[model samples]
Target: MFRVDIREMLVEAQPQMIITNDNLNARVDAQVYLKVRADEDNVKASVYNVANYKLQIVNLARTTLRNIIGTLTLKSANSERGRINEELRHTLLSETASWGIEILRTELKEIDPPEDVQITMNKVVKAENEKVAAVDFATATETQADGQRRAEIKKAEGTKQARILEAEGQALAIQLVNEAAEKYFIGNAQVLRKLEAVERALVQNAKVVIPADTQLINVIGELAGVAPIPLVPKAAASPPDRK
Candidate 1:
C-alpha cells in the first residue's frame, strides 16, 4: 500500500476513489451507491494533521456513506416522495471527486403499492360497475311501462269514438224517415179533398148503399150547408112516349 497525503488529495480533488480498511484507493476500481440530497449537496471534508493517510480516507469514506444514507432516508420519507429524493443519487454523484467516493449505479427501483390498498381499489371498481348496471335496468323498465300505458289509452279512446259514430248514424236515419213521412202527408192534402167530394157524389147517386153502422142515417138536410149543386140535364120523357 502506498501513502497518500490527505492535504494534497483534498486540495487537488482529482479522480474519485474508494478505500477499505487502512488502504487508500485499495478498491478504487470498485464503485458503491450513494444517495445524497439537497442538504448534503457540495459537501467538502479535509482531515486534520492526522493518523494513517489510508485510515483518514477510510474514516472520511465511512462518514460520507453515513451522511448519504441519512439524506436518502430523510428525503424518501417512505410515505410521500419529495423532489429531494428524486435527485438524491444524482446530487451525490457531483460530490464524488471532493469526497473521494465513486458511485457505480443509482437504482430508482420499481414502484410498489401496499397489498391492502390494491384490494381496496378492486372493491371500489366492483361497486361502481354494479351501480351502473342497476341504473340501466331501472331505466329500461320505466320506459317499457310508459309505452304500454300510452298504447292502452289510445285504444280506449278509439273504441269510444267508434261507438259515438254508430249511434249518430242510427239517429240520423230515423230523423230522415220521419221527415219523409211528414212531407208526404202535407203535400197530398188537396188531392185528398178532391177524392172526398167524388165519394160523396157517388154515395148520393147509388141505387143502394152499405153503411158500416146500419142504424145511422146520412142526409143532405139543406142546400144552405152544401156547396153549389152541379146542373144535370133531365132525360127527355117525351122520347119514351114516341116509343
Candidate 2:
C-alpha cells in the first residue's frame, strides 16, 4: 500500500527541495509512524525509484510525519514561539537525508493573545513605569530642598560672624579712647609748667603773684595757645624802596 497526501505537500510546495544523505537510511526507519494517524508505515521503501526521481510517497513519509506533529505541538502551545523551534529542529534531524524532504525555513504568522491577560499586563507595566518616575521626582525635590537649606544656614553663619567681628572692633576702639581721655584729665605735669608761665605773664613787673594750681594752669595754657597773635609793622617799608 502507498500514500501520497503527505508526500505531495513537499512535492507541490513552492521552490521545494529535498536532500537525503543520512535521513533516508532505511536502517533507522523503525516505527516512523509513532504518534501519527498515518495508516501505512511499512511500505517497501523503494517506491521512489518508480517515479524516476527516487522520491516516492513512502520515502517522504517520515518528513511529513515530523511536520504534522511539529505543527500540532506549535498550535497547542498557543504558538508561544519556543516549541515551534524545537519542532522545526526535530523535523530537520528526523528527516535529514532519510525521508528525501527538508524544510527550507519557518516563519511566524498572526498571534491571538488573551484579551484579559494583555490588559492586566499592560496596566501593571504602566504602573511600574509611573512608580519609577515618581521616585525620581521625589529624589530631585529632596536634593533641591537640601541644597537650599544649606545655603541659608551658610548665609546666617556669615552674618553672625560679621556682627561679632564688628562688635569686637567697637569694643576695642572704645576702650582705647576711654583710656586716652582719662590720661589727659588726670595728673599731667605739664599743667604745673603752664601755671608758672601764666603767673610770669600776669605780673608785668608789678608785685602781684597769685597762688599757682595745676587745674588753673591748664586753663591758662589752653587760653594762651588759642589766642590770636598780634602784628608789628616793619620800619616804613625801608623808606619806600629808595626810589
Model 2 TM-score?
Answer: 0.40
Provide the TM-score for each candidate, comma-separated: 0.32, 0.40
Residue-wise C-alpha lDDT for candidate 1, range 1-243, written one tens digit per residue = 322332212211122333322222211111224322222232222122333333434344444433333443321323333342334445545545454433334332222233564467579879999999999999999999999999999999999999999999999987984574365435655543543464576778854443332111211212125433344678977555563
- 10-89 per-residue lDDT for model 2 (tens digits): 22212222222222211112122221113343122223423422233334444543444333432243434445444544
Residue 64's lDDT in candidate 1: 48
Give all candidates' CA lDDT scores: 0.43, 0.47
Q: After superposition, how far is residue 236 of candidate 2 from its true place, in Å?
A: 28
List candidate 1 segments past 4 Å from native.
Answer: 1-112, 184-243
